[model samples]
Structure formats: structure tokens, C-alpha cells
Target: MARKRLLLAALAGVCVWGQAVPDSPGPAVGARVPGFDLADQTGQSRNLHSLFGPKGLMLVFFRSADW
Candidate 1:
């Protein structure tokens, strides 16, 4: 009886954990960026529009230096 109760409690906890939490939507593909200002390596503020090339900007991300 106690073991069955423990199993049911764990199952209930897992069901609660499996629920999806609400989150705010992020930028979608082909969507125009609203533009932002960020500091460069030299600590100077730069605008995203100013960095655009003839072919347009392509943002790149790095997971980590150790990886």
C-alpha cells in the first residue's frame, strides 16, 4: 500500500513536470529585426543597421570558447 502510494505520488509529480509553461514568442525566420545598439569590442556603441553589408547582415552565435 505504501509502495503503491509512493508510485502514484511520483507519477503525479511527473505529470505536473511534463506540462508546458507559457513563454513569450521570439523573432521568427525572415522577420525584420527592430534593430538594436550594442557595445563593440572597443567598448564603442554601434547600431545593427550601420553594420549591414551589401548582401545584408548575418548574425552568428558561439556556444562557448571551451566547447
Candidate 2:
């Protein structure tokens, strides 16, 4: 039982330490994203305003915790 607990604790520590550290937290809900001119997947230049639709745009950022 003790060995199992130790192993579990070690695993937990490793998981915690492996997480990515961002410079700062993400934006607040309904916040405006800053304008950016970045290359798209197809190697084309794209900006925040250029992607807007008739109803405006909704962007989502996804980053793996342990990447």
C-alpha cells in the first residue's frame, strides 16, 4: 500500500510539472482579441478582421496542457 501511494504521488508530481507555462492567462469572456497577421494553415496571411463573417467571428484557442 505504501509503495502504491508513493508511486501515485510521484505520478501526480510529474503530471503537474509537465504542464505548459504561458506568459499570462487567456482573455476574459467576450473580450476582443488583438489584431494579428499570421500565416494560416495554407500558408496564406490572415488577420482577425479578415475572417469576420456577416455575424462577426468567434475564435477559439486550444493548447495542450502538457505539450
Best by lDDT: 2
lDDT of each: 0.72, 0.76
Model 1 C-alpha lDDT per residue in residues 1-67, reported as the tens digit of each score: 9767866867776688865533323565567768789988889998998888999888765576585
**TM-scores, one per candidate:** 0.49, 0.49
Badly placed stretches (over 4 Å) of model 1 are 1-25, 64-67
Best by TM-score: 2
Q: Candidate 2 lDDT, tens digit per residue, 1-67?
A: 9767866867776688966554235775478768999898799999898999999877877775477
18: Cα error in model 2, Å: 15
Q: How many clashes does each candidate structure show, in the order listed?
A: 0, 0
